[model samples]
Target: MGGSPAHLDSPMVDGYGKLQTNGLRFHKRLTKNPCLLDCAQTKEYMLHVFRDCWRARTIWERLVDQDKWVGFSQGSSENWFLRNLEADFNSQGVTRWRLLFGVTVWQLLRRRIDRCFNTEVFGRDPVGVILDYVLEVELAFLNNKNLGRDST
Candidate 1:
């Protein structure tokens, strides 16, 4: 019953955390700005990075109804995933469709951060990002399955 949080272990978490942390540090070093350090340190926390951040809020709103995704507002990321994902997995099955949803969330978060921090882009296109990640994950799963079979 215990495993990493579905959304937390996603590629987006590692990629986004690295980008945010490094961007924070780079901003601090280049500008000699203490305010950048403050923003970076504050953003390192998960709730602030994922739930409360303005960019993340926009993505979350688009992908899920407020009532569905708002559990994270009350609890830790682990709690949110465990409670909600379990319900989703039960209903949807543990197939790629269910797992990819989690991956989509993670990827969208990373895309949102990239669009905001690395580019002049301001809009949050969560649906497009989610679709892209879902297709990528699905392709990876299929490739892995194909590789596992015998050549004969």
Candidate 2:
């Protein structure tokens, strides 16, 4: 139940926080910018990208179903993220969930960047691209954490 919010160090989360508050240097706001996401459900917005985007929702769904962590699917504000970080769960579970949250945000932003600059990396199914990134992040996290723990 006690862990630092170190997972929030992700650059994507920082940029997304800025995006939500009109602090980023985007050429246009969500109201004016073209929604370049594969979902293309609507104009791009912070809440939409993190909480309501169809593709984002899909990722959350998979996390909930597979990891049994339902908290990721909740809340819509920047404050919601802070609350999630402060949520009461067992220490190891809390760390894992926080890491998952950060990884999810990072992958979401990476997907958008890939669409903008490296369309071929996205291939046809963008959801698949996201799933692959999530798997890689989770595996890397497990390896890193295991390396840090003493076997004795």
Say which candidate scores most in TM-score. 2
Residue-wise lDDT of candidate 1 within 1-152, one digit each (tens)? 88666655743344344434434544556323323222435335555555556655565556554455544345776775565565442222224535644765566456555644465553656556566767777788798889889564
Question: lDDT of each model, Cα atoms only?
Answer: 0.53, 0.56
Over all chains combined, what TM-score does candidate 1 have?
0.51
lDDT of predicted model 1: 0.53
Per-residue lDDT, model 1, residue 116, is 40
Query: What residue runs in model 1 are displaced by over 4 Å at the alpha carbon?
Result: 1-44, 65-67, 81-98, 101-105, 108-124, 146-152
Every model's TM-score: 0.51, 0.53
Q: What is the TM-score (0 to 1) of candidate 2?
A: 0.53
Model 2, stretches more than 4 Å misplaced? 1-17, 20-33, 39-42, 65-72, 88-95, 123-152
Report the number of the highest-lDDT candidate: 2
Which pairs in model 2 have colliding backbones? none
Question: Residue-wise lDDT of candidate 2 within 41-68, one digit each (tens)?
Answer: 5455676766677767766665544443
In candidate 1, which residue pairs get closer than 3 Å at backbone N, Cα or C atoms, i.e. clash? none
